[model samples]
Target: MAQEHLDRLTAVDASFLVQEKESSHMHIGGLIIAEGPPPAYDDLLDSIRSRLHLVPRYRQKLAVPPLESGRPVWVDDPNFFLEYHVRQTALPSPGDEGQLTELAARIFSQRLDRDKPLWEMWLIEGLSGGRFALISKNHHALIDGISGVDLGQVLFDLTPVPTQFPTAELEPWRASRTPSPVRLISSGVLGAARTSSRLAAAVLRAASNPARAAGVAKEAMTGVADIAWATMNPAPETPLNVEIGPHRRYVTIRSDLRDFKEIKDTLGGTVNDVVLTVMTAALRNWLHSRGVRTEGLELRALVPVSIRAKDEQGNLGNRLTVMRGALPVYIDDPYERHRAVCAAMGDLKESKQAVGAEVLAGAQNFAPPTILAQASRLNFSTRLFNLLITNVPGPQFPLYVLGRELLDVFPIAFLPENHAFATAIMSYNGKINFGLLADYDALPDLGRIGEEIEAALAELLALARAERAGASGNGAAAPPRIGAS
Candidate 1:
């Protein structure tokens, strides 16, 4: 097979790298729990070794061109050591989920070493319920949630029993000769030239039709301005929108898929709407518990929308845009909250806020690294959204690790500055699991948020049931399920 050229990071991908700070870690990962007695370290190592060929990015390290001429590229790590990337550790005796989560939070607090492949997997043993765990972490620039599908598939088996993958036919990977520094610099120079030429051509082509060019320019300018305004002028500040530190805490809650679908079907909202409504209620309850006023106020969440096309399934890096969510938490009625959330989301979809975010993210491609890095600092310098809520789809089938069936898996949400909390959601089999990230200093009782989510979901489900009965000629709808049970 022919050798591939250096794979440079895309603009949005590079932004994640540039946006990194000592106070905020930008990597994403999952804290996974599997049924145990745990698999042997050697067994887990062998499993990953056999599949390493499928993910070349795993073995490659970050390489930046001289003078920051272009985005960082992926190059073979000549000193790559598989054992270092795949680690083994035992949780203390009586290793309950709480202890395991504490360990995960510590790991999440630290930044990945840029010297090697920006990923790691820890095999954790000694959970209370006869189980072990796989703590997976990867840099945001290396893989988005959609692009990380292969990683999950490679590490898990569909059945409780492991299946053998054919390895004999696979070609061995040998480190290619590293290009000279002079060559790398020259490549950057030429790449910059081509980029410049492309931009010039695009400008000239658009300029050929003055009126059309003006219209396009206006749209682009408006999009950039709108995104800036949305980021700067977010909803009324809340307790969750405070400055954060490096330390982090994580907690998770899960909902039944059938339950969510039933609510969606009966309440006349999308699954996404139901999910947002749940968050609205949980956030409202959490604030009210903290003695914060929640009357007639709304909280804004920055929700990410994936723009990756179906054909671009296997490619790594960021391919998503942010959309604003105005969650009406002040509403006392669960049905009213759901309806408002659904309407707001519909408007957001039609408003093209995500398109504007994409346009803004793409502009970073032309920005010099210094300027881009500075922009990142500014972006995180001020408060934007109260929370960054993200939901990614996962395989609905069961997954196993060395015959240890996975009971629950939750994605880690990396918190940005001035954002004390973030939420990540993923669906698998028949459950939708939500992971919460918060500043350790700000929210020591992060577990309460998880409980709140369950409570809120229950409330919404009851409302859906009431709505269903009313439609069936049962009389006016039951009173809203809110406040105390």
Candidate 2:
């Protein structure tokens, strides 16, 4: 029999599967709000149906080998149905933000079905101010933040006028037949043989050039050492890290992208640096609200770094590593906080943290499924970081879905075991939106945290403006010191 059609999950991708639990659902997606009336359910399905070919994995489901012979593979879901995946729902008339947030939180708390495709899209209507929203949920094993697809990217158009195609012009899709158990086993065996061949080829190349190979090996070892050191030094104890339940609460904060840029240009470092600084300040205040002292506390953030090349933009699965970033909540002054973050982030970029993560993940390519599971657990151990902070850059200009203008987007992040909170940020159309997801019981004050984030950015922006005025020799007095009572 010909080799059954199959694509094995990468070590990084399969790791997400290993990390999932009944309470910890390893899925990452976003909440998108668009202006104008909600599109008809059938019309929306048609739009997605037309573009399913672009993302073939949407129609595919996981297929594990018999007796754990190999890692899971992606196979066509012969029972794939578009309507089942694309759902339509609505809140009561004139639904407010609070109501919508409640709806999203409830939706996010539920896990995606494993037997079918690992994604869902809910078209929510009835928001106050004549708006509609979409809440997407895709298993982390399928997509990462860097290469994640918001339905807008797949269904939206650049202009307000959407592209139109006649119903007759659209072609129907048919999933390939599912493979038998015997075929799955045969494919797993072939896959192992191929992995062995690749390793052998690498050894032959290394032997041909000992000096070059030695240098490469030395760098890999250095990266591994860095990872080991991070693992040994467990993240600091904080209220953010706790035994979280399955339920979740979500809140959003929006800011002008230009404000972040201004801080970067005037105070130095990149926008991401500014983001971390702001988050550090917010965490400081939040901890204090819980009556926890923040003196000399340095929290670690599991910042995921994308290693995907330009040519691999739209490809599915994860191509990313992580860095244990420092959040120096100890610093009180805003400028000092920003400087510390900038310096620490700069050092992390130069360090082998990401390289080490990539090297470790790469080794799993040749390992058995059991070994892969163990390695993945080590890679995302709770001891490694206090919380997850992912910053994904989005399209600067506006996007439209079926002639409706996209107003705002808030990205959703998943929580690992023992992590009570995670923050996901996305910049779109000149606005930086922060989506805060936390355990419903642990963070009943999630809305307060969102307000704190806004206040943090406001303070930073004020300081930046003051610095600019001082540089211009204006007579305006300096603003009050930040973090001062």
Candidate 3:
């Protein structure tokens, strides 16, 4: 038996599984652009394969013992499935936006091999711009969004020079070094006694303060109820919610962070506020173009927030909570949209949604693991939100691998059933890169959506710039008009 029944799945983990569809895997996907000559690609692959030995978990497979309920577990599998996880492919002639989007759709539709450690890397060549793409997928249970970003650093080198990564022996070698079971049991008993004493002291402290204890208990109950409410409610049916086949469409858009910052600096809000504002505008335009018009059509988005501590970078395993917020898609004015998004986000933060998730996470410790896992799946499957939007922060400095400069980085997130699309934005160096993964059949024109996103940002930036000029008593000076393509 596992050391703890609670180890089956954390509440957050269960929620993801419940929402998972055949088209969705809770894994994070990344695109690394590298300038390459065809032959040099082999060298890159060799370097990556050799370094795989350094990350022991990469070689392990998900195993569930017969005594357990067959829940997935990670254990070393000496005879691993390597080829299934890593692959090499080339795009069709002149790999432009259309070809890239097609490739993304194909990649998103396929499921990872669950029998192995859930991860894969694809090296894509033959881009119109003479750049190659590295696409990687890893199981969500293995790494959350923040940790996934950290893992990128491990694979990439900051310096242009080649460097050797640290390596460790296989699990079998380590197991051989372990002491006998008798010694292990003796040490385990002593450790358990110490832990029990500390737990007892903590409980006594809580009991000594009846009023404070009662307040804490009440808060915990409320948090659990809040999470339940959020998860149990089916997401509103939208264009995104439709039966999806095994097909993925990938599209990307890039913008200078300074341009976005300029808008926020003038608008008086954070970068995320600008991002949401732009998305809201684009969504409204897209829906309107599709003849789907409504008054106050509030779109719910599942925003992922990192729960990792400052020191937890590069460490794997999920550590995140979803915050559902209503996007004011009904609004037409750019400035109004910006204000509305900011206000809504501010309210969400003030409401302690993140704290509630933390409390719910804490409550899981007291519940039976199996019960919690079941409850979690039920919550997510019910359509807690209409869509997902995530923002992952990355290193500001340029990253390189074997002297290859990384031009861009994009993130791909799983789209749950009944949810049409998931958008992930990441800041690499000085640029904000947007990656959109959608159900191919449901979102046939995903590339158009990417274009809409660009236009939306441009619209907002124009408004912000004009507003700044007017505020500076330069109304007589005509604001620079944005060019129409």
lDDT (0 to 1) per candidate: 0.81, 0.87, 0.71
- Per-prediction TM-score to the true structure, in the order listed: 0.90, 0.95, 0.85
Task: Write out the backbone clash pairs for model 1.
Answer: none
Runs in model 1 with CA error above 4 Å?
A: 1-4, 160-163, 196-222, 378-381, 473-485
**Model 1, 462: alpha-carbon shift in Å?**
0.7
Which stretches in model 3 have alpha-carbon errors above 4 Å? 1-11, 14-19, 38-42, 67-71, 81-84, 166-222, 225-235, 365-370, 474-485
Q: How accurate is candidate 3 locally (lDDT)?
A: 0.71
Best by lDDT: 2
Candidate 2 lDDT by residue in tens digits, 255-339: 8999999888778888999999999999999988999998889999999999989888877889999999999999999998998
Q: Quick one: ranking by TM-score, best first?
A: 2, 1, 3
- Residue pairs that clash (backbone atoms under 3 angstroms), model 2: none
RMSD (CA, Å), candidate 2 to true, equals 3.5
Tell me the tens digit of each residue's lDDT in model 1 across 67-109.
7877777788888899998998988988887788889998899
